[model samples]
Target: MAESKPSAPRFAYKGSRLKPLRAFCQVARLGSVSRAAEALYLSQPAVTLQLQALERELGVRLFERSGRRLAPTREGQLLYDMARPLVEGLDGLATNFREQVRGLDAGELNVAAGSSTILYLLPGIVEAFRERHPDVRLTLHNVTGAGGLDLLRSDAVDLAVGSMLDVPADLGYTPVYRFEPMLITPPDHPLAQKRELELADLSPYGLILPPKRLTTYRLVDLVFQQNRVPYTVALEVGGWEVIKQYVAMGLGISIVTAICLTDADRQRLAARSLARWFPPRSYGVVMRKGKFLSAQARAFVELIQPERSAPRDAYASGPSER
Candidate 1:
């Protein structure tokens, strides 16, 4: 057997350079070494020395002094803008940890989620959250897959959870869960009597679904087109809960995911496997190309992470999707 070699020594990023980098960034943002020193609670000479070291390290003049006014050199502006967020983020993370220890942490994870996730998955996530991070506030916003991406681009939401119909050039996705679409029918419906239903089986009954604006419609349509099945849509409604309620009222045959039904919900309706071909609906994590998610947002994501057994049904919206 081969023996493992000792790991190489790693360098610390906070080594002698953090003070200089912090001072240089602050001076650039404030455009005055005196102001930067005051803000940092340091002597002006001390701040100036740190800035000098930063300038020496990069071999560039960071700022130009013009009698009572200081302006960043072109290079200084670039460096400061890039470093500002990094240093601020680190500081924020530290403060958050300290607050957690003192029972005074207050923060929200701005999350965009699909209606189904808001309905079914979030409750478990929120319930377990009290045990793990009691002080962190969780703010969830409802967004369609496409709409969620817009929030991410606009920096409205820190992270997005749902099915993305369009994977834009400036976006990314992670498959957190996978669910298969199934046929939903009233308990008394003829199709409800079947053990397994197929896409070809849908031709006999009218369809009930949300409007085309919803991504589920696209997945359903794609399945119909792929399998060359002839099916006419009967009702195009809004909201999955409304659709399910209508199905319970014997509106029409509907299609939904298995996760959407619990034992109680199942009593009101019948769920059958779609023997017909359809792509698996994957719930995903969507985010902007280069956005930094908040610490709470990241932790929530880890907790709600899909297991091997993906849920297939939904309920009414939670605090997330409005």
Candidate 2:
């Protein structure tokens, strides 16, 4: 009789199977290894090692590299299908354990958002969320509007807060707030002489603005186009705050979100609403579709309201002291 080759040992289908499968699934779902590593608190190589080991254990290639992404091969899809329940059951089991041990207060949440969010609105919401769930770990990362969207798509952030200027269709947006763009002008500027101004009225002054590609800029552009108004854009800055400073120093008058006006800003500068309705700009929460939110995030969700709940300038008085 020919000697039989050594066979790989079969696992009993419970514990070890879970962790690797869970990590592997997250890595695939997120389409990023570094993000998965951060989620699991493992080094990048450690996550890669788990994926490599998983493929070797199955005796079939589970992944094929396509550019920077690791996509499931035909065989990989089958394995993932087989592994889904096992991973889900483990997640449920963990949830149950935490509920029993920590009384439903334990969990983790991550948010990535624009820099203005850190200063403007996130502090109160985060504080309230933590007061209710002291056991949960909350983390926030500041990114620019464009960069924040990229981070959300990559699963680097579970939640994103920014201007909904021209969000992609793939995202699910909940309007947290809305505000009108105010004409930001120095106290003595002639544009400040008007109590309310129309788009066409800005022709006399140089203008500073966000890049035309920004959603706010796009909205401003649309307003001017709709009304057949002509105005000169002189300086293009990066953020609303920068535009405000240049305008305050009289470099140029800028159309800016009203929330940017702190008490000091309000003293040196004057703002006016458009004579005709300019499209209102909104800042909101953006999250991905089909991804399940954490419990803490779910609680935070309860606090966001549609644009109708509060107009943009309303909060410049300061957020409801909740």
Candidate 3:
């Protein structure tokens, strides 16, 4: 019999599986073949071929078109939920390995935080981290809650530090600090003079608040709605500093978190605790569930939570409150 060419093995090598898996993960994550191709530095057709091969090999449809985006099918999501971390770990193998050998002397740390957290909470922490590992590069992304969550989901940032009222299933949150809710007004405002602050007392003055889409505005609305107290917003603004400034200028009163309240702020703005009505806001580390934290990332997390470094399967164990 003529020597039969052994049927080419399905995959060229065991390692070849990593490539398709990586391609699948990128497409699933970004929901766009072109974007995934750009991220992977592969041609659009190359990415499409890899995804097609993967589906064929696996005998399952991986994606469905939804509007302009590629939405993962149930099987695709199941695969993605399992494959992303593996691909991420492998993609970062070089960096992680180098960090292990060098002991955090180099490598980059990316963190996402809101402006308030960046300004108030992280200055001391960032200073401490830089002093210890000056050689390590640190990049801080100033983003709002939704923006930060998107970064976390995409693994563009190693971790996020912020307040969390609701923890998603795919992510873990460990609250390290708590700040009381405060109502602020101009120093001479009548509401500031009251010894006892009532939720209903501030109904008369229009509230200056962040956009209604933000957690603070929604939380304030929730509390008021629950109490059946009607309120109005005089100005919908963004940023704690701007809101405080507006409140100081006697434009309107605002409900704010105490994290943004400084001595200078107290000098310019009258602030009273509204904690009795609103739950204390908790600020902490937010990370994707199955993420493989690089050494540089772990070192930063340790600085934030001195007692314990991030747990490997933190989301599985549920959110921890410190």
lDDT of each: 0.72, 0.71, 0.81
Tell me the TM-score of each prediction against the true structure.
Answer: 0.70, 0.64, 0.66
The reply for model 2, stretches above 4 Å from the true place, is 1-107, 305-322
Q: Give the TM-score of candidate 3.
A: 0.66
Leading candidate by TM-score? 1
Residue pairs in candidate 3 whose N, alpha carbon or C atoms collide under 3 angstroms? none
Q: State candidate 1's TM-score.
A: 0.70
Q: State the lDDT of candidate 1 residue by residue for 1-322, as single tens digits.
A: 9999966443233356667778877887787889999999999999877877677667788889877878888898889888888888775887867754554244766788877778866777767765677777777887675677778889988887776556788988876665666678888887877665556767988899878877778777887888788888889997768888988898787877655766677678877766347555666677788876666667766776554224434531111111
Q: Could you tell me which 10 consecutive residues in candidate 2 have the lowest summed lDDT?
A: 313-322
- Each candidate's number of clashing pairs is 13, 2, 0
Worst 10 residues of 1 by lDDT: 313-322
- Pairs that collide in candidate 2 are 178-312, 179-312
Cα lDDT of candidate 3 equals 0.81
